[model samples]
Target: MNHQERTHAVLSASGAHRWLLCTPSARLEEQFPDTTSDAAREGTLAHELAEMKLRHYFQTKEFGKRKYNAEVKKLKTEELWQDEMDGYTEIYKDYIKTLALSFPAEPYSAIEKRVDFSQYVPDGFGTADCILLSGNTLHVIDLKYGKGVPVSAEENPQMMLYALGAYQAYSFLYDIRSIHLVIIQPRLDSISEWECPLGELLEFAEYVKDRAKLAINGEGEFCPGEKQCRFCRAKAQCRARAEENVKLAFNPDKGKLPPLISNKEMGKYLAYGEDVAKWLSDLKEHALKECLAGREVPGWKAVEGRGSRDWTDMDAAFEVLKEKGIAEEILYEKKALTLAQVEKTIGKKDFAEMVGGMVVKNPGKPTLVKESDKREAITNKITAEKAFQEEQ
Candidate 1:
């Protein structure tokens, strides 16, 4: 796996949108350490694999080095490697190859390139996965290994910042007129793109400059919202976030529900419901951690739960079961895994090739959801049914 290097800047492009929204958070976050989760590790592994494939295909000898080979060997053994990862990286690599040849002149291509935006933001720098620079345009492509959330390219600050940084790195030699940002999310079968003129890009740079100044000086308000607090390290303790979540209930008393819940009220809940659920889970995790570390919480305590028994020797256990004349039905239970899980294991394309005709989806049931959700909502009532008249 390509190990995630510790970030040096207080504000990198990855968190620019968040810090831009809550400037003080940039300062506050410095007090805490970086926390790498399993998902992040998986993402790094996926990127490493993608980079390796590109290096090989592009005929770069760097991937043949001992360092790269050792990391690749280590990463491939981990559980994150899947058949689907191959398909995702192929899509990303193929796009980069196509984008390189799309323009009139042969565009210069760089993989896993470091970009600096320190001119606009204090110590601002990031590593863009793939950058293609041509005469009057540049194509910046990013691979998102995540499947839960589909990343969009429309007005995306991270991509915009990457473009700005790339422009800073290459504009002296190339007269760039337009910038293109592409987000490739193969897991979700999505490739979103956006383009902007050089004028608009400069305008955004001005906005980023102002925000960066405030963020560096540690002099901005803590206005909590869903996007800002989604990844904040101090989210649980932030008063603004707590207040926003508390506003969801007129009264959270156990005895009775809120007196009113019209469509307007329901709208607020739907919008903020995911954030509230995340807060609850975060609070529980925090309390459990504290208790495990010898700190006491007011109303909660951790206790061991009932666990199933296991045999010391599987062969002996099987022999004993046979000796007892136990039926196979009692000895084992059978259940099939879902297609989604199998697809992820085998890769999306291969899963279809292997089991395309074997599966069918049932019509979905109606459910209330945010407008942002990809799926269309099914209405509860079908209005104005036509009545049939008897034919002559």
Candidate 2:
């Protein structure tokens, strides 16, 4: 497919999680121009590299070795190319191969396939990185290059939507009874999968349909929350979000400050903390941008912040420092390579075989989390002892 010709739908699959919650956000974001950062560019480059590797492996007839080598060389010439990306993309390709082996026969695999689900969602479409079909099961695989947050496939709206689209497109040709969604984040060493019956997927599709209809028309109340507002373009200026955060500071029941917060209430308050902090940061940035653009922002003006000095020539400065009897070891603090870096240098398989037995993971510090969290709760010894003493 000509990706350049493809236009993003108002109710796009990727933004389903956000738009489904805050239905108005999809339309509201249209006013803001889409901006790309270095991180986004790096992700795009990684995806391209991954796709190339998969094509070479799966469709060697179409993508010849010579062509693959030349394409990879061209990709390496790009500024964002990193040596680590090569290893990570290989990991993705290997995982896809393993998925293929799980099938009884050679599964029909497609790379960078475009699937359409416009029936449920108006003009809804997205590209699945890799998809495999065998017997009664269809696997929709996605590669998440970012390591900022580990993504899970369990009831994940984005993965579910991709599966829905792929199923819709290929159901006629295959008896697809089960749909499997997979999210692979090689950088984080995360591979999560969620499998469901066709009936359950269709139920999810109905849910998407209802939300997409509301989102397309900018209907439903603005429900501002942390995850939904994180990437919303209107997050900085949205009155609903501002109001929600403001309401978090006060208790509607008591119209006044409480002497102390109970432990039970603290969890609820802490949940709002991250959202409030992010909202304030985004608001400040927006105000600074407006001021920089010659617009008036009440009680705020753009000014040069404190700047740090840097050596004009680092190598020359370092040499002069060495000549002045400053010890090289003192000037440059040496540190051991991280586990991940060492693993990468030695090759993952070899590193694991050699030092995997030596590696030990200690218990992490106890952290407060919601009851619905998947992690098993760790008992705090002090709290347990205190409770036992009180009972005695």
Question: Model 1, 1-392: lDDT tens per residue?
Answer: 24477355788888987998899898887776678878888788789888877776564565566755675677679887765667788888888787776778766878788889989999998888888887788888899988887888888988888888999999998899999999998778889999989899999999999999999988889877778888888887677777777775343435656787878867766776768777777778877888899899998898888999988998789779988997767877898878788888777788889998898988877766668776766665553442233231
For candidate 1, give the lDDT of residue 346.
75
List the candidate 2 regions with Cα displacement exceeding 4 Å. 1-7, 255-258, 314-375, 382-392
Model 1 root-mean-square deviation: 4.2
- The residue pairs that clash in candidate 2, if any, are none
Best by TM-score: 2
lDDT per residue for candidate 2 within 163-232, as digits (tens), equals 8889988999999999889999999888889999999999988988998898999898899998899888
Candidate with maximal lDDT: 2
lDDT of 2: 0.87
